[model samples]
Target: MLFGIILAYVSVGSVLIPLVLASFNWQNRSFEIRGLSILLLTSLICDASSMLLSRYHINTMPIVNFYLFAQFVILYLLFMRKLEIKNFLRVLLVLFCILCLIDISVFQGPYVLDTFSHIVGNLILMALSLYYFYTLLKELPTTYIHRLPFVWISFAALAYYSGNFFLFLLNNYLLKEAGSIAWMLHNGLNITKNVFFAIALWQAYHNRKLST
Candidate 1:
């Protein structure tokens, strides 16, 4: 419990650097950098709000649901610029929203935490991350992969979604149990994503200096 608490605290605080870096270079050419910054801010707000609400014995289910759609939209916009499949993504976005509404409104109710949306969202993001990787391999845009912001951000998405996919899958079941350890991995991966996002921001900053 102490360790989990520590991790949770770290996880919440971890986004500051990346979020600052992202905002520092807000007018960036790459949508990925700007999108990631927005995503991190969204995450910080949601996580911090959820924690505060939970402390007050308030239901945080609404926040969880909102964050689900928010990240999806953010990622969709990011991909809309990066990928060549805007039309398909538009249809997919509409369909996904419709399905999630049904999943929340009728099937599970808004207060109950639903895993179906989580499962599906992670899969969609993971697939998109993989496709981004495929483009990287095909295009070979930069010789120094370490300095590529997009590459780092893409991998960060892949790592976060893939690492937590199963955790979200099992969340409904494990959540019912007392003292479940599933959250450890969730917090750990959250930290990993934050660190990676900061690295991506640094790479973008470094690339900016190089160009200037």
Candidate 2:
């Protein structure tokens, strides 16, 4: 818990740096970078809220649900820019939203985390990240992808989503058996994710500077 709290605070700092950089480099505020900034801000707020609500023994699943939905939207917007299959992504996003609503209202109660929504959303995000990579390679054969801000951002999302895929699937069992260690692992992975986000954001700032 303490570890999670500390990491959450660090994550806030990671988000703030990019946000500040974006504000100063207004000319370089591309759609992708702006979406990332908003996503990070939302994540930070949701995480902080979850932590505080948990401390007070309040249910935080609704906040998690909001985060899950926001993540899908933000990631979709991020990838749609370069993906050729824009129609497919749009349909997927619609279905994703509908399913989340149904899951919350019919399948899962508001007080508990919606495991189905989390799983589906994470899988879609992972797939989109992979698709982004595919398109990047196909479209920019001569351009070095390593220098692209969106590439780093996609890589970070891919890594984080892929790493946590199974953990979320087995969350209930893990929490039941090894609650302490499970939370520690969750927080640790989250911290790693935040570090990657910071890197991606910094890369965005640097790339924008180069372009200008």
Candidate 3:
């Protein structure tokens, strides 16, 4: 069940990225934005591939490597951009990444550690996401139409990631039946993400004034 949910979530994101890109093709190329989009899309693809490989009881090392690479690229692009980067936010994000790595590695032994790590990661991610949204929302009222797509995309990312984090954290307690509740959370998050992406695509096209 966990595998299935993860697979679906990634697959939906994969499809939505292209659709959103096509909708906004007229905008002047912004490497930072494009790179971010590609990073996310690639990550989703890698994630989906990993899930499929695991489900088939096949070696998933390659997929995991790809996902890690995609994550690095995303981080690189995020840091390279000359946009505003609050010191506190930067520190928090770095710590969050470190925690994620530790959670994935050292916490893989017993279910207790696994559950604790999951909860911690989810809490940190949720806090970070909320901060991001608050900042973005503050700027939205003064932005132009072309910028709305970017804002909406960020919103979608926040929602999807937050949903997954919460679901995973809750699954540890609410659904202790290994793969049962985890699967449901996985599928639920995917469905929510796809819906957000669909809305984002529509908004992008609308902003473009594209004729159907």
Question: Which candidate number would show the highest TM-score if scored against the true structure?
Answer: 1
Tens digit of per-residue lDDT, candidate 2, span 1-212 = 67666765665455566556556545665888778878877987887788789899998889987886788788778888868888988888888888988998999967777888888878988998998888776777545666677777787778778766767655665556665565556656666666666667777777777767
Error at 40, model 2, angstroms: 1.5
**Against the hidden reference, what TM-scores do the models get?**
0.91, 0.86, 0.62
Q: CA lDDT of each candidate?
A: 0.83, 0.75, 0.55
Give the C-alpha miss distance for residue 132 in model 2, angstroms: 1.4
Better of 2 and 3 by TM-score: 2
Question: Which scores better on lDDT, 1 or 2?
Answer: 1
Candidate 1: which pairs clash?
Answer: none
Q: Candidate 2, which segments miss by more than 4 Å at Cα?
A: 1-14, 172-176
Clashes of 3: 0
Top model number, lDDT:
1
The predicted structure with the larger TM-score, 1 or 3, is 1
lDDT of 1 at 124: 89
Measured on C-alpha atoms, candidate 3 has an lDDT of 0.55
How big is the positional error of residue 147 in model 3, measured in Å on the Cα after superposition? Answer: 6.3
Off by over 4 Å in 1: 27-30, 170-179
Model 1 lDDT, residue 55, Cα = 97
